[model samples]
Target: MTAQTTPKPTESELEILQILWDKGSCTVREVHEVLEKNKDSGYTTTLKLMQIMHEKGLVARDTSSKTHIYRALVNQEKTQQHLVNKMIDNVFNGSAARLVMQALGNHTASKEEIDSIKKYLDELSNQ
Candidate 1:
């Protein structure tokens, strides 16, 4: 099986991947420090999670140093696209319109945001 066939990231892994994506490359201690700023995370927890992620091929480790820098193997945009496609297919019955309608109905949007969305739709329709 190829990387594409790999299972989707677990929730914990996703959190770690997000940090890697944003920070570019980090040591487990650095990641844990950043995560601690946001939530109650521990160093060992981050280190263990990064090791698991490396085994799963979700992250790459630079072993040039004893510090072992970690980086995300997947592109953020590609991951987001795959996740959105899965969500649209499974939760919206493969209908993009239904997905948008459900999301718009469930959340409150500012008038400016609505106008921007309408403009985007118009552009897509024109194309």
Candidate 2:
């Protein structure tokens, strides 16, 4: 699906998507192992989630092998942009500047990240 048409993933689905996005492709067990490190969940639960994600068009499944491999179908950047835009609108009252200010105030950004933000701001001003 197009970025604009990508379905909003549930929190559970988003977690699975993140794993797929990071690892490129993985079997359910591989994903579950990573997930288990953070939270308590069953292998069957991960399998079911991946199946649901496949049906939702959020991920692609390769059934060529006995061990099915799944990969994220949605673009990572697009998903992040979508979620961030929604948060900015709903939580920050559509004020991107306020969102930026709040985030910077609450979080400790690395020097490199601060420099990157400044560079992005400079580019935006140039445009």
Candidate 3:
């Protein structure tokens, strides 16, 4: 699906998408294992969520094998942009500068990360 047509994933779905995006493709059991480490989630729940994600066109399933393998259908960068843009509009009064200031104020950035952000800002200024 085109980026515009891609459905927004829920918080739970975003968790699943993160795993799928990292691993490329994985079975329900594999995803559940990783999720269980971070939260108390059942395998069946992960399976159901993935099934729903498939229906939502966020993921594609490979059912040829006995165990189904799922992969993210939506692009990760596009999803991040969509979510960030929504947050900028809804939470920051459409000011991305406000969002950036809030994020930097609340969280401590590593030296490398700060340098990266500075580099990005330089590039933006140059453009």
Q: Candidates' TM-scores?
A: 0.83, 0.93, 0.97
- In candidate 1, stretches whose alpha carbon ends up further than 4 angstroms from where it belongs are 1-3, 110-112
Residues 31-78 of candidate 2 have per-residue lDDT tens digits of 999999999999999999999989989999999999999999999998
Model 3 ranges with Cα > 4 A deviation: none
Writing each residue's lDDT as its tens digit, candidate 3 over 1-127 gives: 6766779999999999999999999999999999999999888999999999999999999999999999999899989999999999999999999999999999999999999999999999999
lDDT score for residue 92 of model 3: 93
**For candidate 3, which ten residues in a row score worst on lDDT?**
1-10
Best by TM-score: 3
Record all residue pairs in model 3 with backbone atoms less than 3 Å apart, i.e. clashing.
Answer: none
Write the residue-wise lDDT of candidate 1 on 1-105 in tens digits: 364676578888888889999999999998898888878977898899899989888999999988999999977887888888999999988999998998899
Maximum-lDDT candidate: 3
Candidate 2 — what's its lDDT?
A: 0.94
TM-score, candidate 2, is 0.93
> What is the full ranking by TM-score, best candidate first?
3, 2, 1
lDDT of 3 at 94: 100
Is candidate 2 or 3 superior in lDDT? 3
Better of 1 and 3 by lDDT: 3
